[model samples]
Structures are given as C-alpha cells and as structure tokens.
Target: MANLAKIVYRPVGLVGGVVAGIVAGAIFKRVWKIVDREHDAPDALQAEYSWPKMLLAATLQGAIFAAVKAAIDRGGAKGFERATGEWPGS
Candidate 1:
C-alpha cells in the first residue's frame, strides 16, 4: 500500500541507508589501533579514537536520519500528494 510504503518502508530505507553509510565510513576510518606492534590488532586509543572523526560521523548520520524521519513524520506519500498535488504512481 502507498501509505505503508511511504510511512514504514521509505523511512526504513532512509535510515538503513544512513546506517549502512555510517558503517561503511567507520570501516574506512583508522579508528582502531594495535595493542602491540607485533600484533595486527588495535590499541585503546590508537585505532579508532578520533573525536573529530567521530563527531563528523555522528553529524552526518544524524542529518541523514533526521531527513528521513522528518519526511515520515510529516506524513506518508498521501500527505505529500495533498501538499504537492502530485502522486507518484498513476
């Protein structure tokens, strides 16, 4: 249903995208560290302890989450149509 699709599905997609993106970004970061040089593991604050990067990730993820949440909060596709006078599907 359009209602369900817009409300539950779309927001989930948006949130999911944000989550996936953040996760990918985290993977791309050098936030982890190795406890010992001989080991390939990370140290307490060596590998992934960047405050700036963490803040950036949080902001980015929060923004994306907010965007989708706002859309769903406003109302689903029907509400969108009411305001815009345009339905996506015929």
Candidate 2:
C-alpha cells in the first residue's frame, strides 16, 4: 500500500515541482523589481552588472526557489495523505 502510494505520488510530485518553479520565478521577478527598481534581475554573464549585484540576485533567487518548492511539496504531500491515508514519504 505504501509503495502504491509512492508510485501514485511520483507524477503528482513532478507536476508540483514544475508549478513551484514557475511560481518561484514569477515571485523572484516581482521581488527583484521592488528591490532594485528593475524589470529583470542581473545575470552573472552580463558585463554591466557588478559581481555583488549578480551574486545577490542569484542568492535571492535560490532562496525563493527553495522556499516555494518546499511549500508546494509539503502541501502536495499533505493533500496526498488526506486523500490516500498514506504518506508518500513513508
């Protein structure tokens, strides 16, 4: 039963991860605009952006992605458990 639950959750988890990425990207963009008054964050390869600015953008983006992924994953797991009475991780 637990194995079956895990199997069923695999696809759901994949979809959830994709959704999380999309959401996190949007959020990071909005946040960067607010923080820097720019439409886009600095890319590491961009010659005009300073190293500190690029690093700050990278770190902020990473933190946002991690947070969004964790939130989505936990929500999915909780919903799955409620529906199947089995935790996918277990």
Candidate 3:
C-alpha cells in the first residue's frame, strides 16, 4: 500500500509543484506591484536596487513560495492517503 501510494504521489507531487510555482509567482507579482508601485522588484543580480529593497523582495518571495508549497504538498499527501488508505511518509 505504501509503495502504491508513493507511486501515485509522484505525478501528483510534480503537478502540484508546478501549480504552486505559478500561484506563488502570480501572488508575488501582485504583492510587489502593490508594495512598490514605481518599479518591479529587482532580481538578485541587479545592482540598481538597495540592499533593503532587494532583501525585502527575497524574503517576501520566499515566504510566499514556502507557504504555497506547503499547502500543495499537504493537500497532495492528504489526497494520496485518502485514495490509497496509506500515508506516503513514515
């Protein structure tokens, strides 16, 4: 049962990861637009942005990505458990 759960979870996890990334990107874009109306948040390699601004964008993006990933992973695990009658992890 656990093996089957693991097998089924692979594709579900992949799809969930892709979806989570898209959702996180959209969320971060909207948030950046709202917080910094004059310009888009700078990428790490861009030197035009100050340390504080760049750090803020990095922190916000990380938080959003983590939250979305956690949500998607948990949801996928729950669905897998429901379908297989076995938890995917020990």
Candidate 4:
C-alpha cells in the first residue's frame, strides 16, 4: 500500500510542484510591484539594490514559495487520500 501510494503520488506531486511554482511567481511579482514600485526585485547576480533590501526580498520570496508549496502539497495529498482511502504520507 505504501509503495502504491508513493507511485500514485509521484505525478500528483509533480503537477503540484509546477502549480506551486507558478502561483509563487505570480505572488512574488505582485508583491514586488507593491513593495518596490519602480523597480523589480534583485536577482542573485544583480548588485544595484542595497544588501538589506535584496536580502529582504529574497527572504520574503522564499517564505511565500515555501508556504504555497506546502499548501499545494497538502491539498494534493488530501485529495489523493480521499480518492484512494489511503494517506500518501506516513
């Protein structure tokens, strides 16, 4: 049962990961627009922005991405459990 659940969840997890990434990107873009009005968030290679601001942006983006991924993963797991009568995770 555990192996079967793992096999069934692989594709679900893949789709969930993709969807989470899209959602996180959209959210980060919107948030960056609001937080930094005239400029986009800094990438790792960019040095135009102050270190504090860049770090803050990176931290916020990471937090948002993690939260979105967790939510999507949990929802997918719950849905799988509902359909299969078995939890995907132990």
Candidate 5:
C-alpha cells in the first residue's frame, strides 16, 4: 500500500513542482519589477549588471521558489491524503 501510494504520488509531485515553479516565477517577476523598477531581473553573466544586483536577484528568486515549492508540496500531500487516507511522504 505504501509503495502504491508512493507510485501514485510521483506524478502528483511532478505536477505540483511544475505548478510551483510557474507561480514562483510570476511572483518573482512582479516583485523584481516593483522593487527594481525593471522589467527583468539581472542574470549572473549579464555583464551590465553589478555583482550586488545579480546576487540580490538570485537570492530573492531562490527564496521565492523555495517558499512556493514547499507550499505546493505540502498542499498536494494534504490533498492526496484526504482523498486516499494515506500520507505520501515518510
């Protein structure tokens, strides 16, 4: 049963992760626009952007991605358990 649940959860988890990424990207873009007054965040090798700007963008993106991923994963697991009466994670 546990193995079956794990199997069932693989696709759910993958979909959840992809959804999280999309959501986090949108959020980060909006935040970057508001905070930096720019349409796009600086890339690490953009050459025009300073080290501080690149690092700040990376840090903010990472934080938002992590938060959104965790929230989505937790919600998916809870929903799965509610539907199947089995927790997906150890």
Candidate 6:
C-alpha cells in the first residue's frame, strides 16, 4: 500500500479520470439524444454543442468515478498476478 501511495496526489489519476468521464458522457449523451429524437420527445438533446457545460460535467464526473474505481481495483491483477502487470488502481 505504501509503495503505491506515492501517486495518491498525482495529477495522472485526476486527468485520466476526467478524460474517461468525458468519453463515457459523450457516448451516452449521443445515444440518448438519438433515441429521444426518434420518438420526437421534447427532452431531446441540444441541437448545438454545449461544449463548456457538457464537457465540464462529463469530465468532472468521469474523473471522480475513474479515480475511485482505480483505487479500489488496486493490487496486482487477480489471475496470473505474476504474468501480467497490475491494473491501474489510482
């Protein structure tokens, strides 16, 4: 635990998490938007891109989830621990 603690405050995890979140949010947003559009739902996605808010929300949430998941999944891989490297846990 101590050995891996070095990266606890590192920007790598935060940046990575934000990136992942943004990607996931964007994908989900697109899917929902298309579905809503098909049914002519008033809750359809924005016609114009709201990069500022959308990206910020996505990145922020994504980063948090990514970081937590990473931390929990720490410790080398389950099976074949010695064979493959450990998962990125935080």
For residues 25-88, write the lDDT of model 6, one tens digit per residue.
Answer: 5655665456445422122266554556455545655565566556433422232134334333
lDDT of each: 0.49, 0.95, 0.91, 0.93, 0.95, 0.47
Runs in model 5 lying further than 4 Å from the true structure = none
Compose the digit string of candidate 1's lDDT tens values, residues 1-90.
555445544554555566656654454343222222332333236655466645554565566556654554445445656755654333
For every candidate structure, what is the RMSD over all alpha carbons to the true structure, in angstroms? Answer: 9.3, 1.0, 1.2, 0.8, 0.9, 8.3
Cα lDDT tens digits, model 3, 1-90, are 667778867888899999999999999999999999999988989999999999999999999999999999999889878877788764
- What digit string (tens of lDDT, one per residue) describes model 4 on residues 1-90? 988999989999999999999999999999999999999998877878888888989998999999999999999999999999988886
Off by over 4 Å in 3: none
Clashing pairs in 2: none
Root-mean-square deviation of candidate 5: 0.9
> Residue 82 deviation, candidate 3, in Å?
1.6
The TM-score values for the models, in the order shown, are 0.34, 0.94, 0.90, 0.95, 0.95, 0.36
Better of 1 and 2 by TM-score: 2
**Which prediction has more favorable lDDT, 3 or 5?**
5
Better of 3 and 6 by lDDT: 3
* Best-to-worst ranking by TM-score: 5, 4, 2, 3, 6, 1
C-alpha displacement of 90 in model 4, angstroms? Answer: 1.4
Worst 10 residues of 1 by lDDT: 30-39
Give the Cα error of residue 28 in candidate 2, in Å.
0.3
Residue-level lDDT tens digits of model 2 in 1-90 = 989999999999999999999999999999999889954899888999989999999999999999999999999999999998999988
